[model samples]
Target: MKESVNSYVFHHCVTIPTIRKGGPRNNTKTYSTVDDAENHLSPQHFCLPHTLFNRSFLVAVILLELGFGSIPMATSLDTSSTYSGILSSSSPCFVRPSGSGTVYYYQAIQVTVFAWGMHTFSSSSLMDTFSCLYNETFFPDRSSQNLIESDDDSNGAHQFRIRLNLQPGRAYILVVTTFSEIVTGSFQITATGPMQPVLSSAQPITTTASYVLSSSSPEFARPYAYDYNNVPYQAILVTVSMTGMYTFKSSSSIDTSGYLYNEPFNSSDSYRNLIISDDDSGGNLQFQINASLQSSHSYVLVVTPYRKAVTGRFLIEAAGPERLELTTYRHSAGPYSCGNKLTCKAGGLLKIIKSMVISVGCVGLLIGVFCCRPCTNKRKRTLRQQLSLLRQNPISQANSIPLRNVSINTGRTNEIDRPYTISISTVAATYAEQPPPTYEAAVLSSQR
Candidate 1:
C-alpha cells in the first residue's frame, strides 16, 4: 500500500488549445463574432439585469427621508496556526548575526506576531533570551530597509513579542538571539489575527462580542534597535453585509491608533490605500475609525498601541445604527463626533415609510388637485378682470399704441404666475404731456 503525503501542495494545470477527440468539451459552441459570444445563452444570461444598485440607491434615499434604515456589519477574526524552530547566536550583536526564520501565510491581514521562549525541560530554555525581527524582504537580512521593526525586553528578560500590520502573500522573518553574548535555545513562534468569539450567534445572543487582550494574552514584544518588524499590534476584522456607516473604538491605556482597511493588510499597499485611519479624534489618546462600508466585502480593523510601546489590556467595540448619536453631533466641535456613514437601523422605518407612501402619497396628491383646481379657476378670473381694467383705461384702448407685455412678480401667496401685460402706450399716456391730445381725439373733443 502507498501512503499519501499530507504536507505536499497540490496544483492545477491547464493545457492550451484543449481539444478532445469528440466535439468541443461540454458540447460548447464557438462564435466567430464577439456579439455572438456576448449573447450566448447560459445560466448567467438571465441574471437580475444589474439593476439592484440603482434600486438600492433609491430605496436608501427614501429610507433616509422617512428617517429609518441601517445596515449590518459582521466582525470576525482571522484563522491562525503555530510553528516551531530553533535559534543559535554566538557573539550576537547588531553587526554579527545569529539565527533567523520566516513564516508565510495567505490572505494578507493585520497580524499579531508572537515570539517568546517556549517552555521545555532543558535549563537553556530558562536562560534563553531572544529578540524578534520582522520585515517584507524576500530574504530579510539585518541591513535591508524591509526590516522595519525589531524588539527586545526593557528589563532584559529572555522573552520578546511584537505586533505588526502584516500583508498577505508576503514573507516576514523573526530572529532570536541573546541580548549581547552567545546563547542558543529552542523557541516557539505563532502569528494570530484577532479571532471571532466561540459562542457566536446568528442573532448574537449577547449585546456585543467580548474579548480580553494583554501582554499575557498574546505576548507582544518590541525588538532592540528597530532592525526589522516595527509596529507591533493585533488587528480585528469585521465583514459588512450592506453599504452603511460603522464605528470602531478601543479603550486601551496605550495611546492607540486605529486603522480601517478595504482589504486585509497584506502589503505596503494596504497602508497607502486606507479606507480610514484615525490616531485620535480628540486629545484623549483613543483610536477611532469611522467610515461607510460597502456590502459583500470584508474590512480589516486594527487597534494597536499608539507607538508599539507598553500597552495595557482594554476593551474595544465596533457598533452601528448610530442614528441618535449621529443627530447629536451634527455640527459639533472637533472633539465630539459621530460615525460618518449610514446604517440599517432604519429598516423598520423603511417598511413603515413605504406603507405610508402608498396610502398617504395618494391622499396628499388628491388633496393637492382638489385644492388647486379652485385656485386655478380663480386665477383665470383675476386675469380677465385685470385685462378688463386695462381696456377701460383710455390710454390702453388707443390705436397706433406700441403695446409691450410686462411681467410683474406678485408677492401674494395665491397670485397667478401669468405676466401682467401692461401696454407701453398706457405708460406713455399716463406720464407724457399731451400736445392737446392726438388729432382724432382733439377733433372729436372740439366738436363736442
Candidate 2:
C-alpha cells in the first residue's frame, strides 16, 4: 500500500475602497469560491451579498487539500491560540466536511484588524477588512485550533463587529487585537432596586413662669421656661395677652407695658422680655421689669410656647410689690411723739425727779425726827440742857473756869456713882399717913 502525504493551501484577501472627497461610487460584491461566485454573480464582478469572490483562490485551496490526502483536521477552532501581535494578529480557523457525507476536515487561519475612527461609522462597513485562509491537515490533534485578532491603529479606539455560527453546548475563545499598543480599559453594566419612606413622633412641651404683675401695665417681669421631649425644638414665640383691667402694651417709656416691643434684649440691658427656644431639651426664658407699678393695678400676662415641630406650655407668676414710699418726720422735744421722742417724753424725766424729791424729803424727815423727837423727850432733857449749855459757853476765860470746873465735876460725879444708888425712895415724896391703922385694928378686935 502506498502512503500519500497530504498538502494544504489556503488564501485570504480583502480589498478596502479608498474614501475620496468627491468620487464615483460603485457597488461591488466578493466571493470566496468559484462555485460560489458562479452561482451567485450576475456576469458582473459583483457577487451575492456576503458571498466570496475569486475562482482561482478557491482552486488553489482545493489543490492544496488534495495534496494532503487521507489527513485529518480539527473539527473545532479556538481563535485565541493562533492570534499574536504587538498590535495585530490572526485567529485559527477550523473546518469539517461541508454538511455533505464526506468525513474530510480542514483547518484555516483568519486575519483581523481593529481600527478606531474619530468619526462614527455603520457596523456593516466596519467588519469588511477581515480575511481568512484554509488548509487541509493530515493528523488528528487535541490542541486548540483558535486564534487571537489584532488591530492596525494605535492612536485611538478601533471597534469591530463579528458574526459567528457558534455551537450551542461548546465553549470557544474570541480574540481582538489592535495595530497600536493596546490601551486597556474597563466597562461595566448594572441595575438598581426601589425606595422607601420614614415616619416619626413629635415631642410634648411644657412651660412655667417666675413672676406675674397686677398692674394694667404691671410688669410681667418673670420669664417663661419651656421644656420638650422626643422631637427637635427650634424657637419659643411668646405672646402676652391680658384679661380683666389690663391690655398688652408695647411701649418704651414708664407709662406703658413694653412687652415684646424692642425685641432681642441684649446682655447689657438691665431688663428684657425674652422667649427662649432650645432643642428637645428644656431651657429658660426671661422677662424683666421696665418701670415700677402701683398696687390694685390688676393685670394678667399670658405666655405662649412654640418650637420647630414641637409645642410648649407656659405659666405666669407675679413679681412682688413695688418699693414702699414712706414720709419721714423730724421730732421736736414735745408730747405726742411716736419713736424715741415719745419714749423720752412719757415718764422718763418725771420718774427721775419724783424719785429724787422723795429721796430728799424722806432723808429730811428722818433727820427732823431724829433732832426734834429727842428734844421733846423728857428723858432726853438732860442731854438737851447739856448741849444747850455747851453751845452757850463754847469759849470761856477764868470766868469760864467755873463752868469748866462744874462740867468736870458733873462728869466725874456721874461716872463715879453706881447705877443703883439713884433710887426712887429718895426721889419720891413722903407717903399719906396711916397713923392709927394699928390701933384701930386692936380696938375693933376688943369690941368684937
Candidate 3:
C-alpha cells in the first residue's frame, strides 16, 4: 500500500475505489488504480486518501502554476557600475602635448551635427594636474576662442570630456594638458560627441489620441539622410479607420514638420518607405499630410522640427470623415447621415417659412375684413344720411360738398372766376403763421 502511494505521487497517478477513512472498503466500484486523475476529480467525487494528502493540495498546485513563487522585477533601469560598456565612451585615442595644449583630432559631417552620447576622455597617471581644452580655432593664438575645458569626465577620475558642435570644414582642437606647463605624454581620450539614441530607446507611446512631445523627452528620430534639424522626433503608431483621406497636422510654437512612414523606422534606409513629408506648407513651420489611407492599416508618424536644434511643444490633429454617413452614402439610412444633416435642416427651414407665410396671410386677411366691416357701416350711414337729406334739403346737401385743390396752371376765364383757395400743409402754414426759428429754415420756407 505504501509503495502504491509513492508510485501515485511520482507518476501523478491516482487509484480510486476501496479508499476508506479507517481502511479499505470493498463494496464500492473496485479498481487497483485510475488511468486519469482529472476524469476522476472534477465531475465525479473521489474518496481520496487522507493518509497521503489533504484537500488543499490541488488548489496549491493551481496557485504555483499561477506563479505564486515567481515575482517580476520591480525596476527596469540599471544605474550600477555593471553598465560599463552599455553606454560606452568612444574608442580612446592617444594624444601628446607638444607646444601650447595637448591636441586631439575629430571631424564632423553633413549640414548639422547631432551629438550621440556624452563626450568622454581619460588622462595619463603621469600628469597630476591636467585639464582638457576644446575650441574651433585650428591653431591657437591670442584671438582664438579661449579653451573650454572638461577636467573631470562626470566620473571624477581626473579624466576630461567637453562636448562641442563643429561645423563642416571648421577646424577644432581638443587639447589635454596641464594649466601652465606643456606636458609631453600619451593620454587616452574619446574625440567624439555622445552617440545618438534611437526609437526603441525613446519613450514608448501606446495611446491613439493626440500627445505632446518635447525635446526634453527621451525620443527623437533623425534619419541619416536628413541633413537639417533632425531636431527631436517621437514615434507614434496610428490605425487608419477607412479608405479615404486623412490629415495629420501640427500646431506648434516652433517651426515643425511631420513625416509619415509605412513602417517603424529602424535605419535611415527606412525613409524610402516614407508616405509623405510636409513642412511649413501645413501651418507655420508645422506639418500637414493628407493621404488616402486604406482601412485597418497602421501608419507610423514622426514629428520633427524644421530648423536644426529648434524644439518646442506641438499639437497633433487628425481630420476628415472615416465613419459611415447616411446622406453621403446612398444605402445608409442612419439617423444623422450626410443627407440627413442637410435635408433635415432644409426641411425644418421650409416648414418655418411656410408657417410664417400662412400666419402673415391669415393676419392680413383678418385685418382686411375687420377694416372693411367698419368702412361698410360708414357707407350705409352716409347713404341713410343722404336719403334723409333728400327728404329735407337735397340741394343744400349737394352744395355742402368740399372742393379739391385747383392747379394754378388751369386755363379758366378771368371774368367768371370765383374765390380760389389752395390749402398748404399745416406744418408749413403753422410756420408761415409764425416766424422761422433760424435763417436756414426762414430761407427754405420763403423760397417755397
Top-TM-score structure, candidate number: 3
Q: Candidate 1 lDDT, tens digit per residue, 304-377?
A: 56554455665556544221111001213332221322322344467788999899989999999999989877
What are the TM-scores, per candidate, against the unseen true structure?
0.23, 0.13, 0.24
Error of 3 at 236 (Å): 1.5
Give the 10-residue window scoring lowest on summed lDDT in candidate 3.
80-89
RMSD, each candidate, Å? Answer: 34.3, 43.4, 28.0
Model 1 shows how many backbone clashes? 29
The lDDT of each candidate is 0.43, 0.28, 0.44
Candidate 1's TM-score reads 0.23
lDDT of 2 by residue, 1-448 (tens): 0122334423233222222333332443455755564454323231112123344444433333334222221123222212222211111111221112211111122222222111111111122122111122111121122322222222123343333332222222222222122122221111111111111111111123332222221111223333322222111123222211111212111111122212222222213333222211111332222222233222123222222232333232221111221111222333123233333454468789999999999999999989976654654456557656664774643243323223222232533422112334532433335556588789999999
lDDT of 2: 0.28
lDDT of 1 at 74: 25
Compared to the true structure, candidate 2 yields what TM-score?
0.13
By TM-score rank, best first, the candidates go 3, 1, 2
| Arranged by lDDT, best first | 3, 1, 2
